[model samples]
Target chain A: MSATTAVPTTAGRRPMRGLGALTASEARLFLRDVGSVVFAVLFPALLVVGVGYALPGMRDPIEGMGAPWDGHLAIQLYIPIALSLAVATVALSTLPTQIVTARELGVLRRISTTPMRPQGVLIAQVVVNLGVLVLASLLALVAAALAFGLPAPQSPAVAALAFLVGAAATAGVGLLIAALVRKASAAGGIGMMVYFPMLFFAGMWTPGPLMPDTVAAIAQFTPLGALSQALTAAWFTGEFPALQLVVMVAYIVVLYPLAAKLFRWQ
Target chain B: MTTVVQVENLRKSYGAKVAVADVSFAVERGEIFGILGRNGAGKTTSVETLAGLRRADGGSVRVLGVDPRKDPQAIRTVVGVQLQEARLPARITVIEALHLFASFYPDPADPEELLGMLGLTEHRGKQFAKLSGGLKQRLSIALALVGNPQVAILDELTTGLDPQARREVWDLVERVRDSGVTIILVTHFMDEAERLCDRLVVIDEGRVVAAGSPAELIRGGNDERTFRMRLPDGAADQFDLIGSLADVHTVIAVEDEVEVTGSTHVLPAVILALAESGIVPDEIRTMTRTLEDVFVDVTGHAPEEELAA
Candidate 1:
């Protein structure tokens, strides 16, 4: 038997010291997963480049659009849509699956035994996924700007804020999925069910002013729809999408607390 | 022998189904205490309360001088838990897990030393999903000890291991106890509790039915002794005579042999009675009741003894 080490007194112990290490380890694991990385980080960039180059007539000027919408290439509408696709893939699919799997495998229950609070574990998860979302969105933005001649964000600060609120709303939906589902496999299926619909409302099928008025009214309330609207307006028209930002913020306010209350660690 | 953990009449229920009715136990410092029981026998519930993972409906639980429910933060810092079936992410390497868990504590044990202690040094770079069952269990124990906890609760640590692997884990647990951290081993294996625990409480059907050292529980306060003996060729006439003896309780002919159950002196008395009939039984095997027998006697269920070597 080896000699026992000295026992440190419990005075002034920091339980949350592991938060940084926990987040770092989670981030490393997330990167190691090639599938999650490709879908969450690199896929958006691929979408931008693929649609801009392979699809015919993407860079051609529009004919019927007037004033602010006049002379815009067809590919200009895709930048925000691609960004929405990235958020949907990560927040709806990858994030929820990881959380539910960890829960089912007792990872969260194991953390409960440590000095760190269980809430720290959830926070670490959200932070890692959020970091990945930001990277993916930026990669897509750069890809569109360089490849498709997409204009830079006219109101850069507002666009950045809009992107954040939209990401939070999407993450909120993922958190709710994680809270309701008990199985990891089921989480993926359920995420996909929500993913396709959200992408539709984000204007993946119909870009900008081409969408019907009734659909636009309904889509503005959806997280991805609001994000696409905000990103497109701020990028092209240089106008703050105040309604879209408020809608996304409302989704976050409702979804985040609801998910937290329903979240099951074990 | 200071008591580091004390539970008094702990009671808990999930909705209408009661998980723990009444349970109490005190764990002394530096001892490998056991909460032995069958599955769904309130063992997990009791320990979960001590770890502050579950709250008891009624009863007091004090871990290291702090109530687990009232001062959950204090309990978490001092006590560590390796939950049953709890696993790490499939892609996380062994070393990364140790370092991550170590950071959860104020003063943690060296991760390198823990790897060596748990015999996982060579497999440090292996992902969690690639490790064998025994290796996964060893890593779980290593993580439990990495925080330098004052007390560690290991729930069903070796439930899914081969005999050799189980023994290896048993040795590791003893080594952990030798390092001066008190262990509360919750298990369903009779031999595991018998071999590892200094003192154990046997729980059955959500209640503690027996509690003591293995030897004491086996002894069972003047328990009956049983022995089986083969009668000499065609000498069946002496079986009833043995049962009729003063000290003997019941004698039944089982197949070719006569099984006798009686007082502590039954074995010698039966032999004497057989000798009086001028029949010397060729084989007489005296049965010493084990914890298995005691468990059956108390819980009224067949003991779930391991058939491993």
Candidate 2:
């Protein structure tokens, strides 16, 4: 046997040193995935540009409500829907799938053996997904403004708050789904199953203004629907939708802890 | 040598099925200790408990003088583990995986040097999924050692590798052990245990059957040796005389060959008796009991048979 080498003692080193390095590495990996980039970062903007600019009548004002709601174009209503789509794409599809896949692959188990806990990897993943969602939503908003002359938000601060809360609620739902699913493929399948329906109720296929009263009333109860209403109200009327805010807050309060409780590190 | 890992009467169960029961062992520092068993034999459960990944249902486990159940984090800093069937992200490059794992430690080995030592320098740019089975195994070992941990628990370190690759990995493990990192290797291959392990415990059906060095275990169970040679022209008639010798246990003649099995002293005794019978034989070979023989003697079945069962 060869002589043993001298091992340096690690006396004064800190335990939580390289979480930023972990986050940076995870972000690089997230960008390397072409499918995630296309769906989470570019698809929402494409939806806005394709529907708002390519179709002529989509930019025309609807002929329903009296003065307050009159002269509102379908494209303007879609801007909030586009933002909600970005959040759902990232939170429901991208973030959960990534986390579930990491768990299935034993990546989380491998990290658990280290001095740093595996929760750091999960937090890094969430941070990267949230960053992507923000960029994607901004890109869609910018594209809408340039393509069809979409107006800026009436209250930028309230819109920003609504977006933040909406993102948190939707991401919590994603974590819940991730906690429930055991495999990456199942996470993807279940995410899409939940994503498209939530988007439908959020007025992706039919504008919220055009939905029947009964359907719109039911949509208000869904988390994404509440998010869309709050974002649209903030952008159009400059008023905070208190009920919508409460709905989103309720989703976050219930789902986040439930997901955490159900989460399996191995 | 000081004891680094101590497990006493450890017990665990999954629902109604017991995975491990009454398992106890201690590993000395700077030794390549082995836990040898078939699949589902609780070798992994025992090792995982030592690594603080699982909570034992009964008994006590102290890794590096710290109770794993009391403080898993304390062991985490000093122990590194490479779990069975665990993998890195498919899209992560080799260097990126190393760096990511390296960042988890307070004083990790240099990623570039570690990769070079593992013969992965040329494949640093390859994604994890793109690497071959041997390369993947090497990368896993590299990651396990990157933390500069005092103790490493490697589960099935060379399961799927080809013979040459397995040898290379064994060499790397020896070097790692030489660097004073105590290793607890979990494997079912008896040849691996015989070659690499200084001391080992045989776990069968969630219990330790025997524990000792390879030579000691073989001697403890069955010390019989066998010698075979081509039967000379007149030697077949005197087989009974050789079988009646003091050290000879059995003698049989089949076609052109005569086989003798007995104690270690039987070889020379059989040879002298055959010569006295005026027979000069060619093509003589001796077969000694190996760890595999010891394993079969203790477990009542071969490792492969257990795996198939």
Candidate 3:
């Protein structure tokens, strides 16, 4: 028998050399999933067109607001709501379910036995899900703007910041859910359980201004609610919503590390 | 021979159940070593610990001379593992899975060559969920060898395969070993171990009951052979004479046949004694103990019995 005399030397590649390949493969699998595509990519845009443009008088200016705010259409507020829904669909439903399923299938365990760390797969999932969420959000925005003549974000920079922070906070919560649930089906059930309530607070069922005073006050503290408010403020008023940004930042601070600590490779 | 894997006094427990207790074995470089046991006999757990998938409760494990616990990633790079129940994504095609796993290593085997070697070229585009059980097993084996690893740990490699497919997989294993990859095969199939393993350790109830080469273990047990032959209808009186022979250990008459069991010399002596008595045996058969018998003898129970228990 021939014995190996020396260990093979690794070519000085970056530690994360495989991340792009991992993410690309995960992206391919993610696109093939019809349920995930329908909910995360198509559903949000459909909601915007069906709810935003189909409703009469939604395109007209809102009453009782002064100056530039007074003439903005109520349908415009739904754009941010649509974007938040995109984030929620991927982060709450798709991301956690995929992670938990991978764990259950021993996909992560198989990857752990390779030269690459199994965490690389998790990171790849995050990157792919986030990319899908962004693309879905962009599609929603474009579809809404073309169908309903929705205006562009007044503060593009602040809107970008809001989207980044919201995506981080939402995906962090998804990772936490993946960490807590041992079964893939349980992750899906728990994810949808968290999803509907967050969507309700983000004004999916009723516009924020039309909700009762108490409900509106409570909605501002929710992660999706804060994200919706920040995005709306950036899109219409050309200003950053400090309080909403802080709430999202706080969610990231608490959820990210907790998920990391509790995560199980097996 | 250089030791590729050394596991000493390995112990593991899940809650109150001791899955593996006091297991020890050493695998030499370029040899196909085996851990043989029935289901739930801790063979999988022992190999998982060697692959660095599970932390040992009490033991020292060195794979290619590196402590797995201290450097799991380093061990992972050199030791490929085909876990008993692991799988790829349901929608991933066979070629996709191969390419993806290939990217995980710095020096991976050519995916096309690997696919050809495992006879998976035709199924390259088939989704994982659509493959048959035997095909899936072959794919799993191919994935384990894609990294050109120094050591490969395969757990229950042919559990669900039919006889023909099982033989095919065994041939593939032999080819892999011929290429100089040290293999630690975990199996319960006696024939598989007997045919392939250079050395093996038989585990029972979370302990190593016997360890040696198949030939050595079989020889270590009773070397006596049993012989049975048909005598004339009136030869029953000769049973006592055969029993009284110097080399024969025991002699008994069943119906019209006489059964004699003793050392190697007993067979010839019994034949000569029967001839001297004017008895010509029409039928004679000899039974020799195999490794399976040795396993039963040493473990105090058959593998099936241990499994049922």
Candidate 4:
């Protein structure tokens, strides 16, 4: 038969099967993408281990939270730190770069012509990123538990909630940045610029509350700082930090719509 | 028949440069419609708008009878695309790329079968970054086709390939067209367009200056024959005598060279006249008009100058 004839390749399939297919495809691609895999898993895990190992008596501080906590109490603090970096990498660097290259390669344009939704594209990205972070976070937790005696999470539900919230906030911001950047090359630069500052001010390096008065106060208002505070509070105290939660949620609320408006699928 | 793609007065600008302006076209179902233009002729911008990748600064577009901008989700499920200049991750094998893209569509082609058809079966395990340029381009096409799209948009279809590889790509494109899918081929190559397209539109300065079948265009471009003749010493005066014959419209001479512009059918008579004059030119050549020539004539500049225009 001639090539033009609609072969039975994908015919007879049920409609609306694209989303499932898209999700699977996106997940697999994310898994194989070395940069993302490294960013989501190894990078965060290394940072957690490196930072945890560097600070003596760090585990004492967490177990001192009045309860026995878990094995390596200090590792609990590092859990949120590792998770935050994973979220930022997936949302900011990995996701944005994917879209930018997709645009450059005409993948976005091709998707645009398909029955696929731009929102679906974004959904796939978030799903892949979130899934990767969850997997990596789990591994990091296990590794930390084994090596440094890191505390097992007290509240798994709260950790999950914090992860979702943190991921949502970062993914939204990353999508906005991706939409705004002109080309693929700019994605890395923009991600680094946004990432380091966010990591520093968000208390991943030092608690915003502990910084000198002016810096701490300003850091509190930054999205990362708010998100990190909220994530830490959720994982550690089991009490949601309302203000920080509001700021994190507010980042998504503003950025998601703006990103949708600015996103170029072609 | 319903229109599969429609574009109206589409406009797009980046900074001060207008990428596409007042561009419009429509593709009926199951035709290999070509968009021919020089580089930077707004072909990519126009296609991007229709593909729903870039929002138009103005005008409207409908692919598969839906507004791409308003209902991008609805559009994505039905359309299949392979973007220009896209590269898959280096670590992802060919099989991996196919599986990933196939997951995006509800019904996707079998990855193994796709690899086999695209001559990539042996390289399925190879990373995308490790493939040759031609192989990468083939992989790109395979990725586009895996979703089993109704309409396929290919930009620079045979670019960056050796002549043999280009011909192979042409065969593949023909096969795609034979499958009864409408194609919007964006290319700067005249020979490619002439060989593959049923009908085409030409863009100059962000607007379509010509549109028709390649044959119709070649025929319509002012019927005139150009002959180049190189002669020995005393052939000029004899060539002038031949030029005075009927249907010998215009003849110019620069030294021993003779250029004849007239009916191609009358060339033999001119040659016979020359024979009678005992004037035998050493070399004789005829100019057969082509799309390339028409492009030059219409734009009043060589096609090369407009490569990035």
Candidate 5:
């Protein structure tokens, strides 16, 4: 029953002040959230390193061409693939889990109450995930180039385009998963179940084209199949598929907005 | 004063289950209006609609004169919300959480001032998971107020606080109200509602069963008032001496436990007589009817009555 403090009059201002502020705040939160940071950057880099080390001693299906499997070319080939996996893991696992956890924790629920747009929230996730994916991909590439004598890419533009396409496609798929699953535990499982299979099928371990006819046909149609094809063609053969790029772009255009629409803040 | 929040026949249902049915209430500028109900009584659902979290199947809601469904984003900037069920990332530190939430607002309260006000200045650097429940709750409160909002929505404001912590929260809430920020309090604790809210709405089974000031509702129930006395040890016979005094209607005693039922006019006289007799009870308190009693009368249970039953 003590005297109340002075009332401030600040509500006369406009809503949706500026995305820059929100984006900065979200970025800070993402960095402050140590688990998300590791998941986005450190974990993916570790995975790429593990895959690179594990691959050098194994049989290379396309090694007959003397393409130098452990050199920069092979490792550069992994730049896009590693980035793709990183993107998928980030959008699928990190975004969905955060959304679900936000809902459970009432963060989303509270956010829903404010003038903050659901779109802002989605944009924040994409921004954070994109940062993670880019940083992780860079770290992995630098490590591979320095430590294992991984090959540098023949075409930087092709490699960059391929990485962007792969990241967008992965983000779309991740959004779809987040929209469909509202609970953190369920979303985590779905994200892993859906993305890990894509990794194995996308030539992360076994080349997709060398697989049995049935396996190759099925893999070709999956989203990951297109990504693997795009990256493999760009890095290994110096050949980029315009059609595959178009298809990847199409996947992004369709899934990104769809996820945004269905994404619940609460 | 103009109403800061208005709801008309707000309805929300999930599949076949109606979570909130025709719940409507208004909160004036700068008043703490509590929504009192047990769990599953549609308190959360009702607040969600007002906050634009859940789409109401029927009716409409307006906060700061904006339709939440049509302009959820616009509404969010003007109102701060502290949901009962959620938490920030476990790794997030207290000051970090404050800064993060404050970033959403064009003009936000100072994070340092917010921490100081909430008594979280000491734990500003602690990670969210490491904080105690009361500390977490306080952080959430700080987050909700960071936007420098004209209105604040809080669910289960003091559900898990120890007495001292609860008092601290109550003080903070009072401070928020003083800031001219309209508040919507969703809780089942009648005492909390009585102590915090200027007016309240009670819900049961997704329907609003009562709405009024706490005093009016308590008076409307017309419940019998009781005088309770805890006498000193070996003072069992003191009840007999007090029970026979003038205006004392019914004196019931079992061992040292004593309860006197009478009109408000007579209870004080009896207590005064007891004090005059040189046999003062260890603890003497008048039992007035509360919102809890009214809930039981109207909804057939006490505040925590549902869970207890």
Candidate 6:
């Protein structure tokens, strides 16, 4: 062999540089899964469109309520509930399953052999899932405003903040579930175990003013419930719901690093 | 030739499991080095240490003159590894996987060139789940070489592949070596080791049982002639003349096997003596000791005793 053909085994490239390509690759993979797309992105809009057209009572003004809550329609309240479902679906159902499946396939181990850290894959996962959650939220909001003659969110910035922190809080829980699972089946099973009950508290079955007073008081303590209340509070009141944001941030603070500590590479 | 990988007295264990009790080898630049052993042997553990996937409980490993334990991060840049049972996501396309892994290196081989070179160009758009075992292996090898490392470690490259696919992968390995990258191949298949390895260490039950080229191991120590034959049902007596020949040393007949051990020219002498008696043996296999026999001779067990893990 000539001197020009001599191999130069480097220590690897810049560590952070691989993240963009990694996220793009993961995004493409995520887009290929029909199950993830249907449940994460389309389901929330389906909830908005289906409920608006199917249940005419939802588009009418909510009755039997007085003061500031009087003018809001049942459909308006269902929109935030649908948004909660959006974040929960991807964060709980899609995120954990994807992570545990990659672990089962030894993707983490394979990535570790490169110059990039395995943590890059985790960061990419978070970024992709969070981006999907945001998209799902906006799709639900836009569908409600365009189809039902609902106005724009009273405070768009506050709504966005609620979406991010709310989605992150739920994603943190999904990471913890992924960290605890050894197989994709187990991830799906455990994610389901945590999913439906959380949705129950988030008022998927009971919109604002429709839920019992005691149930609403109880839902404030749960992650998705806090998210639902936060989004609802941001929309009608046009203010940052400080207590709801704190509750969501608390979940992120406690769950995310714990998931990282417990992450299983293979 | 220069030594790019040097390992000495490597030892690793999971609690009391003792996965690698004692192991060592040196790999020359631009040669395919084999770590030959059966499943449950220390072959995987030893390479895992060299690749910096595992820390040795004892001993030292240096890949490209850098110690893996002290600086595992440094080794990752210099050595590209295709780990046993390691796989890409099922939905990832072949081309996407190559491009994705290429992003991890400062200087990477062209993805298109790697695809064409590995015979995966047509399968570039195929999802990983849709590829055949051979195609998946080709993609795995492409990912390993994508980083343009000086050394590539491929563990169990053809474990689940068919014979034809196995041969194709072996040919690919040779071509890769021809490109000037040193390869460390870990496999349980004796034929794979003999066909591709320039030099190898035979690991058995977490220890080095033998070390040399396949030919050297077959030639064995002291260069003695040993041959085995199978005779007709009642032709055991035919060994009487061949045993007494001037060049012959010993003949042992047991069941269907008639084995002869002797000095030079003994094979031809025995054949000539057998021909004179109007005796024709059903089968005669001469002086050919494959890696299987070498393994048994050293480890006191067949190489296929354990399941392929």
Compare the candidates by lDDT and give the number of the best one. 1
Per-residue lDDT tens digits of candidate 2, residues A1-266? 11122222346446566788899988998988988899899999999988887878888887766644578777878999999999999999999999999999999998888877888989899889879988998899888888777777788888888889988998889999999999999999999999998998889977756667787777777888888888888888777788888889999999999999999987
lDDT of 6 by residue, A1-266 (tens): 12212333343235566789999998999999988888888889999889888986877876768745677777888888998999899989988998898889899989988878888888898788878887887798788888876656778898888888988898889989999999999999999999998899899888866789899888887889999988887777676788889999999999989998998798
* DockQ leader: 2
Residue A264, model 2, lDDT:
93
lDDT of 6 by residue, B1-309 (tens): 888889999999999899999998899888999998888898988998888889899998877778788777778877889888887898999999999999887778999999999999999999999999899999999999998989999999988888889889999999999998999999888888899999999998899989999999988774568788887766677766787898889999766788898886778888788878777778987767788888888888887733223
Sort by TM-score, best first.
Answer: 2, 3, 1, 6, 5, 4
| Weakest 10 consecutive residues of candidate 3 chain A by summed lDDT | A1-10
TM-score of chain B of 4: 0.87
Task: List candidate 3 stretches off by more than 4 Å.
Answer: A1-5, A9-14, A60-69, B14-17, B232-238, B253-258, B305-309
True contacts kept of each: 0.63, 0.61, 0.51, 0.39, 0.38, 0.56
User: Could you give candidate 1's per-residue lDDT for residues B1-309 as a string of tens digits?
Assistant: 788889999999999999999998888889999998778889999999999999999989888877778778777877889989998999999999999999998878999999999999999999999999999999999988888888999999998788899999999999999998999999988888889999999887778889888889988675688999987778876756886899899988888888899988898888887788788998988877777777788889976665543
Candidate 4 or 2, higher DockQ: 2
Native-referenced DockQ of model 3 = 0.48
i-RMSD of all predictions? 5.5, 5.3, 3.3, 7.5, 7.1, 4.4
User: Cα RMSD to native, each candidate?
Assistant: 3.2, 3.0, 2.8, 5.4, 5.7, 3.3
Model 2 regions more than 4 Å off: A1-15, A61-64, B305-309
What C-alpha lDDT do the candidate models reach, one value each? 0.87, 0.86, 0.86, 0.74, 0.74, 0.86
Clashing pairs for model 6 are A11-B77
Q: What is the C-alpha local distance difference test score of candidate 1?
A: 0.87
The prediction achieving the highest TM-score against the true structure is 2
Q: DockQ, in order, for the candidates?
A: 0.47, 0.50, 0.48, 0.28, 0.31, 0.45
Mind giving the per-residue lDDT tens digits that candidate 3 earns over A1-266?
Answer: 12333344344433655777889999999988888888888988998888866888887888896645677777777888899999899989999999999999999988877777788888899888878887898899889878777787789899999989988898888889999999999999999999999998888877645667777678778888888878878887776799999999999999999998999899
TM-score of 1: 0.93
The sequence of per-residue lDDT tens digits that candidate 2 reaches over residues B1-309 is 778888999999999989998899989999999999888889999999998899999999988777788877777877889888999888899999899888887778999998888999999999999998889999999999998888999999788788888899999999989988999999999999999999999998889999999889977856688888886554556677887899998888766778889987888888787788777677788876788888888889888632210
TM-scores of chain A in all candidate models = 0.92, 0.92, 0.92, 0.80, 0.79, 0.90
Lowest lDDT 10-mer window, candidate 3 chain B?
A: B300-309
Per-residue lDDT of B255 in model 2? 66
